[model samples]
Target: MKKSILFASALLASSMLFADSLKLEGTIAQIYDNNKTLLIDSIYGGQMAIKVLPNTEIEMDDCGIFGTDKDGTFKDLKVGNFLE
Candidate 1:
């Protein structure tokens, strides 16, 4: 009975990890479109890789390059750009 209860609780915890929303706040490091992975300079520490979903939204503001305003997109994001 105890073993069964522990297994049930473990299953429940694992399922919740997969179901919860994941948010990563950081700066852009490297973007791999083919692999659908984004590398970020995480505020928590060094860089980390986060998976990108089809529904993920990337927003950019106050972006300028050498005095030219720029919008952030998959193609426009650079090494120094911020991501959340």
Candidate 2:
């Protein structure tokens, strides 16, 4: 049998290393499209499984030399991408 771990976004707040509304920096380790969840490997030496809810606000930043910033959707997320 396979066991799946679910990480609720709310837990970040009460984490010993995190404060309320703390921003997380990490790389996208895995993407579960069917459930709209992402497994992230944090630079802080931790992993997080975040589920994307329907009302969750999403955004992508423009770090390219000449790219413009724009709104983003879950479909735009990819493995190996760095996020903050």
lDDT of each: 0.75, 0.84
Model 1 earns a TM-score of: 0.56
Q: lDDT per residue, candidate 1, 1-84, as tens digits?
A: 999999999999998998757566788788887877779999888889878676766565653665554444566667777776
Give the C-alpha lDDT of model 1: 0.75
Tell me the TM-score of each prediction against the true structure: 0.56, 0.68
RMSD of each: 5.2, 9.1
Q: Give one digit per residue, the lDDT tens place, for model 2 in 1-84.
A: 122223444454458555555788899999999999999999999999989998877788897997777888999999998988
- Assess the local accuracy of residue 16 in candidate 2 as a C-alpha lDDT between 0 and 100: 53
- Candidate 2 regions exceeding 4 Å error are 1-20, 65-67
- Give me the overall lDDT of model 2: 0.84
